[model samples]
Target: MVALMCAEAVILGTNSKDYQIYSLGDRIFCCAPSTGIERGIMLEISNQVECQYRERGIKPTMDQVRDMLARKYENVSSENVLLVGQDRHGPHIYAMKGIGIPQTLIYAAKGKGRDDIIGYLMHNWKKSLNLAQAEQLVRTCLLVGENDYVNMCVIYKEKETWAKAVPQLEPVAIMAYDTESAFDDMTSMGSNLSN
Candidate 1:
């Protein structure tokens, strides 16, 4: 009997305090986020890819590298990896899981709060969000979430990607008030939360 393995892909980004965003050229952007054992796996994969690119002086297509890693990880039952990159043509997002064989994750895959987050993003996300806007979406997800599993996040494109440590947000001093009044209250309390 073949035992099937399942895993969830974690898409996280850092808090606003310290964020690392990179730009390679004019089009390519990249960000990688992994945790648990997959952290080491991701590092190894990234190092190998960088080494190869250095030697060849040419970057391989994201699909090619992804398929190669999937093959390498086919033996693992549960693995989570999220790699976001874009080329001149457009963006390429890869959310992968190592089941019986490593398979790419689609938008429909459900794992805990994954569905809710995906739904939130689907409604808020657009093709036209600039780099800052994109980063905001990621930050908002991590900042507003109740989940502890996500401690990091990566937001990347073909030219630049940002990775940062996402610190948990403290409970807000919520109060009943008008919208404008609430905004001012929150703004004042926001600085205290960071302290």
Candidate 2:
């Protein structure tokens, strides 16, 4: 799983079913290496967070979520949770591992291929990236060529959260007699790669 703060929005991307992401009120939560027990824990916590938001009109802070996770650490000691949300302090990203203190960050990635994804983001991410660019960067980081679908969650500041499964186009295989010309042709105006 990967999550990044881009422009006025936070984007999360994942290609695995074991690490599912969920939207709770204005926040997004995801657990790594999810199992029945971990998923139940996440759902229960999400419900609590949502209820608080609905009844009090206040979003849960990262620290508060960390405390909640800390209490449930025994049940999900091997799993890590990543959260992204907006509050009075503005948008934030947090990473929590077991009973350790949560770390605030501009971006976070975990689970399989996390190192590679984090490396790519560190080199390619920029503060000026728009929503589309950020989503593309995440999709690229996931190496979506190998996966058929990429699940995404976007939390926009002061706006409703959006979540979807983006389908990836099938990789094309081509044999060109003239390699340079073929590359040029693919980069031409009408080609999908032109953009």
Candidate 3:
């Protein structure tokens, strides 16, 4: 799974398992999966994020990297998230989703249950009143998947500060931050996994 935030160009997404934040020439090249774990996640996440940016003068980058983690280890997977906008008040910060933008910042648990991520995020919202403190408000959130009980999380203090995915084997190994990093990851593995 993958995620991104800009508070710049209005966070958009091109969800792909093989994501690699590439630093090409004048422009950075983003090569992520056109399809994969991020199947529906991208469309839904992006639309919501964009809506949050509207009327707020907040713009997310189209080139921002998505995904929580990237790994070269064959057994490692990853989950990712990023922030893009400021708080309703302009800098202090708040979640894009919590601030009346329901889908902008989604945090769904991988286990069994409906919208566990939503419930978890809402809980944090009330506790901290600030995404920063709210994010730190970690809980042993659980979800029952068909085959496993995954405990996942997505914490964001603002548009720029966030921690994606819990620790289900590190999610998808979201790695390769910059262009160089993406290049190395691609050359090393050649598998589907990027920013």
Give all TM-scores, in the order shown.
0.51, 0.70, 0.24
Off-target runs (Cα >4 Å) in candidate 2 are 31-34, 53-58, 159-195
C-alpha root-mean-square deviation, each candidate: 20.2, 19.7, 20.9
lDDT of each: 0.45, 0.73, 0.32
Candidate 1 per-residue C-alpha lDDT over 40-151 given as tens digits, one digit per residue, 9 for 90 to 100: 5555666766777789876756575666556656766543344444444334455555552434432222233455556667787665665556555655655444543323
Across residues 129-193, which tens digit of lDDT does each residue of candidate 3 receive? 44333323323332123323222223222443244555466457766569987788778775554
Candidate with best lDDT: 2
Q: The CA-based lDDT of model 2 is what? A: 0.73
Which scores better on TM-score, 2 or 3?
2
Instruction: Put down candidate 2 lDDT per residue, 68-158, tens digits, no spaces.
Output: 7667665445435677777555677877765645678898887777788888889999988899999898888766336656788887765
Winning candidate number (TM-score): 2
**True-vs-predicted CA distance for residue 194, candidate 2, Å:** 74
TM-score of 1: 0.51
Name the weakest run of 10 consecutive residues (lDDT summed) in model 1: 1-10
Number of clashing pairs per prediction, in order: 12, 0, 48
